[model samples]
Target: MTTTRTADPTAEPGAPSTTTQASLYQQLRAHLAVLRLYDAAEHLPAVLDAAIAEGLSMTAALERLLAVEVDATEARRLAGRLRFACLPTPATLAEFDYDAAPGVDRALIDELATCRYLESATNILLIGPPGTGKTHLAIGLVRSAAEAGYRTYFTTAADLAARCHRAAIEGRWATTMRFYAGPTLLAIDELGYLALPAEAAAAIFQVVSQRYLKTSIVLTSNRGVGAWGEILGDTTVAAAMLDRLLHRSVVLNLDGDSYRLRAHQARNETLRKTTTGTRKPLS
Candidate 1:
């Protein structure tokens, strides 16, 4: 047995007709579908109910409906941007442990999050010892840029060099350069970690030179600038690459005990305490 309820007396004029609420809701959804406003259609019922219950005017109701759709569309766009970013992980600045790396300046990181540097194609260099959270900070910055609607990409320095070499071997040097240069922000992680090929230095230098003053770059390295000549096995190439990278860059140096080592020590301590607590006094 269907029970009929009266319409809201305070509902805005030109609201749905005196038909059953369910039928009117379905009809409105169908109309929205025909107009290709799927996001708005999905939220119509709630917005309509709220409007009627709150005695909102027609304009306010329409605005509320459109607002939700806009929000949903923006969310979808952000997701797409992140997916295209090719990030290694979904690390955000909020997840970074500031206390663990006291050398890092939180204020500087916060400023970078504003993404104003992207307009002028500034660079970010995360320099520190291994396990000093350089990669984490780079990932965080890349994620921030992605959220800010910048096209971003992430790759390790070694991987980038290899890809560049492979692209050259395949006779797609220009295409590879374009691919690396296409993103508004490119993150190169773990630079100078492993010994790269002899040609790797030039390959990397080309990439840096091509993107110079045209797009932003965020790179993490365990080695200092002075040591890059040895790491890349080419002093001249390394210096040229550094010139372009440092011209418009913010260098963040991280210093702290390795996070992995700290965790390992904590686990060992916990095990020792547990063993001691369970042991009986020796006879």
Candidate 2:
């Protein structure tokens, strides 16, 4: 025995045709499916009507109904430029000894969530051996700061030098410096991995010197502090650059076996993927 219902004169245009209980269930299912809730949300009247007819808990029904809606709103909250979303959570978990430093306290990781130093224009330096989470920490902190309403820009020391060289040739060196220096926190990774030319060294020094007390920066490098002079290839310029950078900086020294080296030896390593691209294990 089926009952038919007439359409209301005030129904909205393009509204689903719901002339029967079955039709109403079908419309609801279609609406919910548009939001992608497909676990038994088929166009079946008995499924929905039975719940309502049996006086099931409305609270429970509404909870199930709005699951997708809550997830969508949360996804939008994490909307910031990310360098590498593929960074495994294991890197940030407590298993990593994030607190093994003096000035570079892991305690700051919690404090930095509020972006105080970034707001105050202080720089952070993560000095460590290769594959000891220098890049990971820098990227993580940049993501944290960016999510807290600060703009973040990431580049390697090599690419930065290359771009600066290009800008110099094009007579826009200052423009390029401002481009990278504009971010609330600029994450410059691998500062000493590749050798840099003299002019690139000076331009980089100029940028660092200018940002002193004016903006925040985060750098990760595999080279030791003494070797930086060699990497820059100009002892005088390197000294001056360090003067400005180390004035009020939090310096982190990471000392350990290369996590990368350990993984390669065991053959248990997985290639880490980044937004720019994927790289195989570096020897």
Candidate 3:
């Protein structure tokens, strides 16, 4: 028999023996394991077989294997970010109904969705009446920030104030401030929804000042800036906070009929039509 040297010099081969092939595969798997490429290691056998069947080059095969690992890594990262964000619900700019609020500037919203404002540490103020979709827009923007690999947090203004108040009482005020200030984009929803605790204005001001020119904020409020003093219970504190927030900010005023009310009216109309039809005899 004419002997031929296989790729592995010590292999007893005309073609590589099954034992040698298995040994090499095990070594590859071990190396991947050591590198913490668990996803790639798990998919190795199938990927390698497909690569061979397709006659792929070594570099191409490696690329294909690494792509799987990359995808899995991204999925894990996004899930972690979303969990940390504590977003009440999933909302995206694409899911918003611009037609429902004619006063909303669709072009401006599209621009904001690109997330360029975050890069400059700009604030976004969503001012509107109740049920005008301010919270929806704020959530959507924060989701975009999170998707863009920025650390994000979501909380209602009332909840944030209460937490800060409690933290102060527990003597963990500094830690609480750091937690709120840490996110690249901090979204405070439902500002002015309910009366905040006493000293809440000072707490909120500290959070805003801490992040001023350092990170971005997206706040949704039912009351306009003029009424913020009443909401925060201190005109002076509100002014100071607004000074920092508005210095580099995007203020979006969403003016329109309440989406919830519109939906309710629509349902009532449908019911009325159905009831009237039911009263008539079926010919």
Candidate 4:
């Protein structure tokens, strides 16, 4: 015998008779919202359709969605860290003029870009003459650290000293010192540009001492270690600070003529040629 079944009167012509599918979708979206998985919730419908079309298993589809959320969250976190870093500008190792500063160890700089020293809390000392790309290299490494999920801060030596001095006057020296020492990588640029007062020098020494063996520092200086005493105005204090910083540090000495001066000279030469070309010939 053959039997025929009739459709339910409540069913729409082209729609499912049961509300189970709609209810399940609503529940899934509610759970996603509650769990703060906004990205997944937003993309769920399209992703689900694609997954079904591709014959993906439920677990595989879920994994793919979660991966997207994870990547977005990590990107936002890195952006926040970069904003807090206060770098002079965004720079990268690729932008450096390796050929111009042949004295600089390109291999060593490439290694530093890997950011392994950060894990060991090792310091980096970039010593070079003015305009020899010391600050550029320092800033590049700081940017790399920030991107690699390390807390980073950048400030010139004079500015840092002034800030510390002000903090001392305001009786917030400890707080300021903690701020400087807290970052995973703290870059101090132009360390020998200006002579610091005894009090300021002491404050800087305190920062080095506090972060000793615990955090990394990227220092760019125009003066050599021997001249630090005169720059800081205290030989004993300089010696103590150097001892702590150099214990686990990589010193990179950049020896080259000033890139800025060379650029200036080239520009002047071009302008002179242009002026001569435009002048009338002497009879």
Best by TM-score: 3
Where does candidate 1 clash, by residue pair?
Answer: none
For model 1, the superposed segments whose C-alpha errors exceed 4 Å read 1-27
lDDT of 1 by residue, 30-137 (tens): 998998889998777678778879999999999999998889888999999888888887778988889999988889889998999999999999999898888888
- Descending-TM-score candidate ranking: 3, 1, 4, 2
Write down the lDDT that model 4 would get.
Answer: 0.88
Local accuracy of candidate 2 as per-residue lDDT tens digits, 1-283 = 9998687777543244556844775577787778675543542333345456667586765664465456554445555344332222323323345543333466766776567887678888888878777877777777777566667777888877888888999999778878876777787888998877777787788778767888888888888767778989988888888888888787878777676776686564333334226655679
Clashing pairs in 2: none
Error of 1 at 138 (Å): 0.2
For residue 158, model 3's alpha carbon misses the true position, in angstroms, by 0.5
The lDDT of model 1 is 0.89
Q: What is the lDDT of residue 18 in candidate 2?
A: 53
Residue range 1-283, candidate 4, lDDT tens digits: 8967566777433223347865777788799999998888777777777787798898998998888778888999999998888888877777999888998888999999999999899999999889899989999999999888899999988888899989989999889988998999999999988877678789889989989999999999999999999999999999999999999999999988898998999999999999999999889
Runs with alpha carbons beyond 4 Å of true place in candidate 2 = 1-80, 83-105, 268-283
Residue 232 error, candidate 2, Å = 0.8
Clashes of each: 0, 0, 0, 0
Better of 1 and 4 by TM-score: 1
RMSD of each: 4.2, 10.3, 4.6, 5.2
lDDT of 3 at 88: 90
